[model samples]
Target: MIRTATPADVPVIHAMVRELAEYEKALDEARATEEQLREALFGERPAAFAHIAETEDGEPVGFALWFLNFSTWRGVHGIYLEDLYVRPDRRGGGHGKALLTELARICVERGYERLEWSVLDWNEPSIAFYRSLGALPQDEWTVFRLTDGALGALGAPTR
Candidate 1:
């Protein structure tokens, strides 16, 4: 079962975020805490939203955290999926697709113009899965980021 996550789901969601960070080789950089997760996801004015994946009997195995984005060209809202993960043993089932489809349904119902996300270039399995879902890579554009300390230094480029 895939459903919108509530405040009570924070612990499991935090654990899965850690697992995903570890899998992506960024465990040491993860700074998420239960309180932070709860506040950002369930606070008075939420910064993001999540969807939980559960078994027939109600066991959360994974989740996806996403939020809205605006595209000036489209003049409509878009959903940016920040994270989508399932446990190793839970792969090969339909959970990932189900989660993605549910999000797509929201996009349709709410008149969103598109849904977008980024995956590591080296993660072939995820790339293939996304392609299989009818998403074509936008080869014309490149992704860039300036995180942590570098973000503040962006205006001071040096030779």
Candidate 2:
């Protein structure tokens, strides 16, 4: 079963995030604290949302963390799925698909134009799964980012 995550699920979410980072060989970069997650997910104004997947008897297995983004061309909102992970041992039982299906339903119900996420280039299984679901890759586009010292430098006032 999949359900909207509550504040009580923050720790579990954080753990899964760490697991995901480990799977991607980037566990050292997974530094999200429970306090930060609580503030972002259950604060006065939420910056993101998540859904938790569980077994019929109630053991959590996976989660999908996402947020809304706007497309100037489409003039509609789209969901940017930040992370989707299922316990390694529990994979192949449809938990990942179930999470994505829920996200797709949210997009349709809310009139969103698209649902998208990034996968590590090495994650062939995930790529295959997404392709099987009719998701096309925007290979022509390159992703860029600014963070830490660079971001701070950019924001600083010049003399």
Candidate 3:
């Protein structure tokens, strides 16, 4: 079963995030803390949301973390899935699909226009899995970001 995450699931979610980063060979970049996740997910003005996938016996096996993004062209809000992970041992049990299905349900129910996310170029397994879900690659678009020092510099006053 898939259900909305509560405050109590923060620690497990953090662990899974680190585990996922490790699997992606970028564990060092998974710098988020449980406090940060808790604040972003459950704060008075929440900026993100998450859902947990649990076994019939109520044990958590995976999670999906996401946030709303607005598409200017569509003039509607869509879900940008930041991370969707199922433990290595728990994979192939439909948990990953269940998590995504829940997000799709949320989109349809709320009138959201899109469900989007990024996949590592080299992660063939994940690429295939997402493809199986009817998610197509936006190959023409390149993703860019400014972070940490670069972001600070850009926001700083001109000399």
For model 2, where is the 10-residue window of minimal lDDT? 113-122
lDDT of 3 at 141: 98
Arrange candidates, best TM-score first: 2, 3, 1
lDDT by residue (tens digit), candidate 3, 1-159? 999999999999999999999999999999999999999999999999999999999999999999999999999999999999999999999999999999999999999999999999999999999999999999999999999999999999997
Count of backbone clashes for each model?
0, 0, 0
Clashing pairs in 1: none
- Model 1 per-residue lDDT tens digits across residues 75-150: 9999999999999899888899989999999999999989999898889999999999998888888988788788
**Candidates sorted on lDDT, descending:** 3, 2, 1
lDDT minimum window of 10 residues, candidate 1:
148-157
lDDT of 2: 0.95
**Tens-digit lDDT track of model 2 for 1-159:** 999999999999999999999999999888889999999999999999999999999999999999999999899999999999999999999999999999999999999999988988989999999999999999998899998899999999999
Score candidate 2 by TM-score against the native: 0.98
Off by over 4 Å in 2: none
lDDT of each candidate versus the true structure: 0.93, 0.95, 0.97
Query: Which 10 successive residues of model 3 have the least lDDT summed?
Result: 150-159
TM-score of each: 0.93, 0.98, 0.97
Off by over 4 Å in 3: none
Evaluated at residue 26, the lDDT of candidate 1 is 93
